[model samples]
Target: MLTQIQASFAVNALTVSMAGITTDLDTPATSVGTAITAGTFAMAAFILLGAKVGSRFGTRGVFQIAVAIHGLAMLGVALSVSPAMLFIAQASSGAVIALIAPALTVFIATNYHGAQQARAIGFLAAAIPAAGVLALILAGWFATTIGWRWSFVLMVALAGVNLVLSFLVKKVPAQPGLSIDWTGAIIAAVAVILLSFGFSGLATWGIWLATPQAPFDVLGISPAPLLVILGLVVGQVFFSWLRRRGREGKPRIFDLRVLATGSERAVTACMATMLFVGTAANFLIPLYIQVVQGRSSIETSFSIIPYTLSIFLASTFVAYLYGRFTPRLLATTGFIVVAAALTLLAFTVRGEWSQGFVVAGLILLGLGQGSIVALVFNTLLSAAPKQLAGDVGAWRGLVHNLSGSVGIAVASAFAVGMLSSMLLAGAQEHPEISDELIAQVNFNEANFLTNEQLAAVLESRASGPELDAAIAVNAEARLRALQISLLGLGAISLLAIVPATRMPGRREGDLPEKLEPDDDDVIDPVDEKETVA
Candidate 1:
């Protein structure tokens, strides 16, 4: 549980520190965004290798080394003087998390069974939101008082504690004869990295069409979607290679046996959806508070507290309910709650921050998010045999990190596109304004700006009516873009219910199995229950 908490905290600590880093390094927001994107990319791209490495080497030995590496990365981050250094530090932390994730999951699977295992998984799930809350409070304070670098200092301390605690964990026997398929690993890494970069570029580059910021274009179309498409094609190739290895009795990066059933795939889908929505919301809310409202990081953190707290409390409570209710029932209910909350939030957004309605909506989202995360994760863990836990962890890491990147990218692109459209339409409304003035403001990109900055930009050239028109148009367009994005997020949540329904109707407690890798048959829920009887 501490291991999981450390991992999540490292991921989230940057949230409240973005402003400080940008200011101190004299860099644009994109640099900080790149740091985050690189970290997530590294984690998702290498997680399968991390799983296999844990199996090939000893889990405990690899875990300790990973934690040590992570601690060193945090120290590097604390001493970073430029955005380049920060990016490298963050990427290093990400690579280490790839190792820690599988080790922690395998530890839980090996050491616990049945209800105890379910509880442990629930605690792991709870740690994510709990860590978010802690990061916001502590990281926000550190960023505000000392510097953003000190937040990394905090992570270093936590990593040291986790390294010491790693020794206490049960040691699992390593598989001696497993050989890594370097070809498959390279293919998988390339596929995930391409997909992550594609999504990350969608906001700066165009989503469907080419933008001025695009590095290069294919004929005339944007390379973002092209990369995503190509990445998917390559991903299929990797899976085919895995299937061949499975048939030939050769070692593969991922354990193909864990994904043999529809239930397992469905659980993956649910986790991906939950993470996508959560990541999108987390990114957009801070952006609104800081960029639009001109609030401090602490203020942004305070604004999000209700959401984080709700997730932590709900996750802990819902774990107790897993033995009594089916995952399908719990997941279905959670999605409905999230969808409704997002709808309410979409309607409630305005130029003036509606604190009451926003808090209400966030709390509701927290409830559903907490429940789905804990319940679905437990379901996925319990579905697999104990020895395959590392594979399950790798799957979790891949889905989560990939979805997070996609969610942020899609939200950014959607909001930017809508804002551009709105700004162009508003500019058309005021034909009195000069084309040169429009170009100067770069209204096509439509970044949020304070009223004073807007006035300053127009003071030398234009006066009363044109300036007022520009300000009104920019404010309205920005708010509208945010609202539309929230609604789109709601639509994504509603769609997730389709996968949520595919979860097994049986409770997780009845589905525990102790099969080996050589077992050819799938663990049918009914058969497993009968065998336990």
Candidate 2:
């Protein structure tokens, strides 16, 4: 729990501090989004390798070393003076997380069984939201009162605690004859990196049309969309390469057998969808509070507390409900709840911070998000064989980090794209502002500014009528863009209903079939308390 909490703390803590980092570095929020997405991308890119490496070395040793490295990265982040420095630091932190991710899951599987396993998984899963709540409070306070850089000091502290806890864990023997598939790993890494980078640049490089920042154009169209397409193609190639290796009797990066079943695939899909919503909310809410409202990270934390706590509670409680409800039913209901919450938020967000309305919507969102997050993971663990726990961990890391990266990328792109378009439209409506002013500010790539920042810029450039008109247009555009983005999130929530329905209709306690060839490897669905291994 300490290790898991430490990892979750490192990432979510950064979210609350994003506004301060951007301001201090004189960079845009999108750049901070890029840094965050880059970290996730690095995780997705190397997680499978980390998984296989753990089996080759030892899970405990590798995990402990990774934790120490992660702490050092946090220390690096704490002293970062530039966005580029922060980006590199975050990437290093992410790579360390990749090493630790799979080992943690393996540790759980090796240590417990059946009911104890379920409870253990519940604790591990709940640690994420619980840590988020704690981290938000600390990070927000530090960012507001001391300095945002001090926020990483907390991360470093948590990492130290986790490292101390690591010594207490029992050491597992290294699995013999496990070899790294360098060719397949390289291909997979490239695909993931391309996909993350492509999506992250969608707004800056243009969604479909080429922009000045674009490296190159595809028949005069933006390469961003094309890169996404190419990434997908490369991903297919990577999978094919894995299959060929498996056919040749080579030691695979992971046992693809973990995802061979229909129920397993459904679990992966559900997880990805749910994470998309959760990750996007994490990014957008802090953004709304810090960037749009011009509030401190502390305010963002306070505003988000209700939602985080709900998730923490729901995730903790839902693990025990596995025998009582079907995964399909729980997931479907969760999606509907989230959809409703998002719809409410879409209509309720006003120009001014409507705390009551937003909190109400967030409470609803938290209930659903919390329940689904834990339930889906428990369902996945239960469906797979005990020996395939490492494989499941790799897949979990890949799906979660990849979906999170894409979610942040998509949300950033959509919000920025809308903000730019709306600002242009708003400017056009107010012809009182001179063309000279528009050219000076360059509304197309204008950074999102608070009222104070806008006022400062106006004071330096223009006075009276022109300044007032610019401020009015900026305010109108910002509000409208936010509303539209919330609507988009609501629509996405509704779309998840389709995948939720695809989950197997079996009772959560029922096993579909033997997950492995040896009968000893098959967990008995009847007892529900016996060790499968």
Candidate 3:
């Protein structure tokens, strides 16, 4: 559970410290965004390898070593004075989390069984939001007060504690003879890294045409879209490799049986969709509060706490509803709720800070997103045998990291892109703002700046009514950008209903007081020879 918290904290705390990083390092927000994506990309790329390595070597030993390394990484983060150091330390922490995440899940399989396992998974889901809540409050405070570095100093101490406490977990049996599939590992890592990096870079490097910020261009086209295409192709190759290995009775980096059935595949899709929506929405809220409104860190915490608390509550208590509702039904309703919440937010969001309607929309989002998160994992884990626990965890981690990276990337790109278009359009149409003044301002490099930031930019170049109009346009543009992004994400959530319907449904009277142990749950995955669909 602490491992899950650490994973989530890596994202949330960095977000809270963005302002400090920009100020202290004399770097732009885009640079900070890149650092955050580097961590996420590392996690996505290395998670499957973590699972295989843990199975080849004992999970207990790997977990401890990873935790210790994570502590050192956090220590490095605390001392980082440049963007490169911050990036390296954060990426290292994310890479080690790839090891810890699967190890934690495998430990649950080793230590718990049946209903207890379901509850444990529920708690694991809950921990994600719990970390968000903690990050918002603590990271915000630390960033506001002493320094952002102190927050990492605190993480280093917690890592040390986690390392010591890891001794309590039961030893997971290791398979020394099971050779690590290096080919599959390389293919999978490349695919995930390309996808994660490509998605994240779309904001900076143009979505289609090459932007000024792109490192290189392919015949006037951006590398971002090309990378996404290549990632998809390589992903298909990884599946083909898996099929070959499964046919030859060779060990795979990931077990196909974990997602062998159509229902299981649907479960994975639903999980990713739920996480993407939640992560994107969660990211956008703080971004608007911090960047657009120029709010304080504690203010960000106060504004976001209710939403995070709602998610935490729903995730922890949602297991009680499992007996009454089917996973399919729960997932369908959850998507609906998420969509409705986003619609509410879109219609009600304004240029100002949090309003009553905005708070209501956030709470609705939290409840829906939280329920689906716990339900999907419980459904997926319950279907897989105990031996495949590590694979399930690795896949879950991959989705969690990839979806999070993509979600934030899409949100940033869409919001900033809309802001850029609207700002120029508003300037072109407005009677007060002159085209000459607009020419002086480079809309191409537009950021989610506050009125003060816009004012500072326009103050020296031009003054009076034209400057006011430009600032007003910026204010309206940034807010409308957020609204449009929310609307689009809401539409995607509604479309996710197609996948939700494909998830496994329970029979009319299949209600059990607890998710009790079944024969399939205890079966050894190696003995089962189900073909991958």
Candidate 4:
């Protein structure tokens, strides 16, 4: 269980760090948008497929296969030349996750029970965030020194290690004669692909009903909004198909019956919200350090050390709090703390603010997000039926992965949109500014400017004293653009509060009530039953 947990964390860390590096390499907002979409699409497809495969082959088999696939995919990403190749590699890696995640959950259920299972899952959950910190630090250093390719190479090596560890596990006997839902799989895949592409396009292109012409002509026509609509329609059809198949005694992609449980819904919601908050913070902070503060990649990664440490510390102790404190209280408090940190960050992002503010904010955010995530996963697994553990685990993974991807996507879109709007507003206010000047001013490097500096630059551009004023104005504008983007991200953090409220209050020692036998069952002499019943 520990090995699997560590492997899962390592895999996620590699993927996320690679994503951040890819954004840096492909500097434009459009590139970031596209990469996020491609990566997300690939992840969704892989997880769904992997779940089906696990059902047929058993957890260990699926896990080993995933490890191999992940290694190859990492290598492919490292060697990729074109954007298309990168997308393909990302999708393949995502597929690997699908295989491994369900298996990991099944393994936990099979090997451990009760509080031990909860603790193991908590530890496993913590591994991801912990690994993320490590990945970011490593990626920043490697990207700065050896280049992003080396990071991928490192990922391949980690995947190899995971493969070896996976082989050490004893295999569970496979469930015989399980059938795969091919049609449902195809529909789900298509829906995810279309939806990811559509959302990516929205982030790159304008989100208005009618597309604006200023951006590079995409497919010679705007396809974002259209694709989103198509995806929704396709998703509806997929769900209908699943329903029909269930009625026909054929296998279905999603077992909707499992979702009927309140605990299941709450757990899924909590995980989604946790991912949303955590990923949004992760997405923005690096940009804040590297671009706005003009920190080197290594420096930026180092800056996150406080956050990483806080997460590690917080995660380690959450298991102790379970049973003593309800998940609702812990999660709610976490969300509030995170929100407070974000709000503080928004206020402190001026020229006069110290680096300490940023570090403090990062630490708080990490502590809150890390605790909530660990707690939520532990609770969800405990709440689920033993027989349905694999399915529930897959569902949890699906929601978390999807939420993280969408959170980043939405955050990127919102930040970019706000930055663009602010830039345009500044430009309009200074009508004399040239397009070249505006282009220079529109650079979206994070951490490059303070709000006051940006305002001053806009003022100078409006006054038009000299060429130097123009340069200053451009620089300031670029800085302000980055600042506003951070603010947008901070605002998004508040959304987590709503879902956090829905979490149950159960703590670690509080055992859930076991299900009673159905009334039709004949009592065995060895079993004790209440005489009144």
Q: What's the lDDT for all of these models?
A: 0.81, 0.79, 0.83, 0.64
TM-score, per-candidate, Cα-based: 0.90, 0.84, 0.89, 0.77
How does residue 521 of candidate 1 score in lDDT?
52
* Rank list by lDDT: 3, 1, 2, 4
User: What digit string (tens of lDDT, one per residue) describes model 2 on residues 398-456?
Assistant: 88877876787788778887888988878777878888877776655765677778899
Per-residue CA lDDT of candidate 4, range 430-498, in tens? 646666666655344322344345556556444434344444544555556555655655555566556
**RMSD for each of the candidates:** 3.9, 5.1, 4.1, 6.7
Model 1, 396: alpha-carbon shift in Å? Answer: 0.4
Better of 1 and 4 by TM-score: 1
Candidate 2 whole-model C-alpha lDDT, 0 to 1:
0.79
Sort by TM-score, best first: 1, 3, 2, 4
lDDT (10s digit) by residue, model 1, range 1-533: 77777778866787668888788889998888788777878898999999989898888989899998988988987888888998999898888889988888898887877778777887888888888888888887888788778877877888889888877779888877779888999999999999988888887788777888999998878899999999999999998998777666567788666776777778889999999998898777777777667776677678778889999888888878876789998898899999899888888865455568877988999899888988887888877766678988898888888898898998887788788898888877787666777777665566656667767877887777787888787777777788888888888888989999988787645234653222335544433442343
RMSD to native, candidate 3: 4.1
The lDDT, on a scale of 0 to 1, for candidate 3 is 0.83
When summed lDDT is taken over every stretch of 10 residues in candidate 1, the lowest stretch is 510-519
lDDT for each residue of candidate 3 in 1-533, tens digit (9 for 90 to 100)? 88677667867888888889889988898787777777777878889999989888899999889989988988887888888998899889888888988887788777776667767877998998899888888888888799888888888888877887888888787889878889999999999988987887888898898988899999999999999999999999998998888777788898877776677788999999888888799778887788777886678778888889889888888877777878888999999999999999899876466589988998999899888898888788777766777888899989987888788878888888898899999999999998788887788778898888778877887788888888888888888998899999899999999999988785222122223333334223442553221
Error of 3 at 166 (Å): 2.3
Displacement of residue 330 (Cα, Å) in model 1 is 0.9
lDDT value, residue 169 of candidate 3: 86
Predicted structure with the largest TM-score when compared to the true one: 1
